[model samples]
Target: MNATNSQSPTIVLVHGALTDASVWHGVIRLTQAAGHHVVAPSLPLRGLASDAAYLESVPGPIVLVAHSYAGSVISHPATLDPKVKALVFIAAFQPDAGESSAELNERFPGSKLGPATTTVVPRPGGNDMYLKPEAFGEVYAGDVAPDVVSVMAAAQRPIDPAALGETLPARATWHDLPSWALVSTRDLSLPPQLLGFTARRAESHIVEVESSHAVPVSHPREVTEVVLEAVRCALS
Candidate 1:
């Protein structure tokens, strides 16, 4: 391959709370099949600042893909970094300055997530949380198979409460970069209208799908297509 052609921008996938990088398994497979480099790093789910810093540490010129709460991370330095060429949000939170995942979760009227979740104190000063296993399948991954949802529920990560309430920095790459979004119409974790609000605010190229919040797992083809679109934009 010529040097120019060999230099495809890397696709960095960031997973949100209640799930680890494993959530992007299907999306990674499809992106890799399309001959693009892809990496899904585990977000700490401790706080947005730490997660964003971790994402920023990756060498860039990357197509940054954020799922769920991760949208908040990539919007900042994760996208603002000079190496980030474009951004793709898959049913993710995209908060502006002074906004937060906790705030946005209640911004619209469709989400049933808050009541379904329960918290556990991970330490003396803070807490970590997870969705009730019974509600996990219906709310977060409705389109996924039953067996898979069972496995996902068993392995779901606990997100630190700080991550959700942490306010964002003053600036975000979405405010200035080329961006694309996959709006999951069936998403109960982050409602479709809420996703629409964020995507429109960022002026992102939008594609709507009838999947749940776990769109990467339930609608990998759709997620992959959006990622490829961002990759094409980065390459151009």
Candidate 2:
């Protein structure tokens, strides 16, 4: 699975809360054009342990790319599947062991994702959280076009409330993997400061881009570049 090998490693793009795998559409196109295989799996948005277990089941020799809440999901040590050689966090949370994504989000104060910007729908066992459509563009995709933001708003996914508070069960896998991160400087969903803090703590190769929380859609080229860099470094 190293760079010298004939087969290219897979690039698994994982989306975070309030979005689905479609969030990786642009990144997938670019990465695929560059001759790499890419897959964006739809996370169930359940609690952390279950979500990480689901991610672990994806076939590997992989460059795992995570956006937003998926950061916490991939941070689980169980996701350290032997073939997951690298981690790329795109404006995402990279929590340490015993830390929850909610905790990380509040660690720094610029996040605008509070009750005013979100809605909670009660499901049988827990609550599902969604970004309010009217606030989605401002809070999650401010840099994107209005029409595209409308479509994204309509298609946004809801995450279980438990996912936010669910603590990482063991050590962060990033501690054992080569990692990279993109800090969305203008991001309003998760504060850019929080992103910087976690990325620095993980010692990931970091890039700062002026984007909304939706960096994959707003700055796909930069996102793709980071993912490709991780692939090159991890495989080499």
Candidate 3:
């Protein structure tokens, strides 16, 4: 777990639905500038278990950072390698055993938090879907600038809806790991209060930023600070 040794906690960036790892470009550069290695993986988004497994496959100093739907991916029951230091959630879901995004959203029906149209659909190919651009911005990037939202929105990939529906079998990750959460004040997709609830649920060290759901892009400085803090806390 020492940087000098074989392991150094590299930040593993997990993008939200309908987007690729590139969505983290700005944040990645920022993190690297701060002298931390980052890995923003392109998740299959087909199932929570599969996505978590894919992420664990990356190998080496990994710290799980799940955005939006990928939260479920990190909270999976199986242990992500011991090399993983901690988790950073960017307006991401933080769930327990037997929970799914659909079940969680059901708690807040008809959320103005999301876009006028929802792109989270049934499996595009098999068990995943992606959020549409309008929904991506209106719901996910409402706080982000129009231009940034446009580009990040266009780069989004489709995720399978099954990922949303897939419930967690083991909630150990939530309880076992040390957690940090960055709340996007202007997020329309999940609603601000929902994020607050998440902070409380995970008992995380909460940091609220005046950004959109895409906090990593909308507020890279703030995001970088939190990430840096996580690294220090982990190594300490």
Question: How displaced is residue 183 in candidate 1, in Å?
Answer: 0.5
Among the numbered candidates, top TM-score falls to 2
Q: Pick the candidate with the highest lDDT.
A: 2
Candidate 3: tens digits of C-alpha lDDT, residues 78-171: 6455777888888888878888976776575334533346544443357434566666677676777888778877776877666788888865
TM-score sort, best first: 2, 1, 3
lDDT of 1 at 197: 92
**Would you list the clashing residue pairs of candidate 2?**
none
Summarize candidate 1's per-residue lDDT along 1-236 as a digit string, tens digits.
11233589889999888888899999888777777777888877778888888886788678899999889988865448778889899999888888989899888988878754654557656777888888888888999999999999889888887788988878777888899989999998998999999999999999999998889998898899999988998988
> How accurate locally, in lDDT, is each candidate?
0.85, 0.91, 0.74
Task: Give per-model CA RMSD.
Answer: 2.2, 2.5, 3.2
lDDT score of residue 90 within candidate 2: 97
Instruction: Report the C-alpha displacement of residue 97, candidate 3, in angstroms.
Output: 0.1
What candidate 1 gets wrong by more than 4 Å, as runs, is 1-5, 77-79
The residue-level lDDT of candidate 1 at 174 comes to: 89
**Count of backbone clashes, every candidate in sequence:** 1, 0, 13
TM-score of model 3 relative to the true fold? Answer: 0.88
Listed in order, each prediction's TM-score against the native is 0.94, 0.96, 0.88
- In angstroms, the error of model 1 at 108 is 0.4
| TM value for model 1 | 0.94
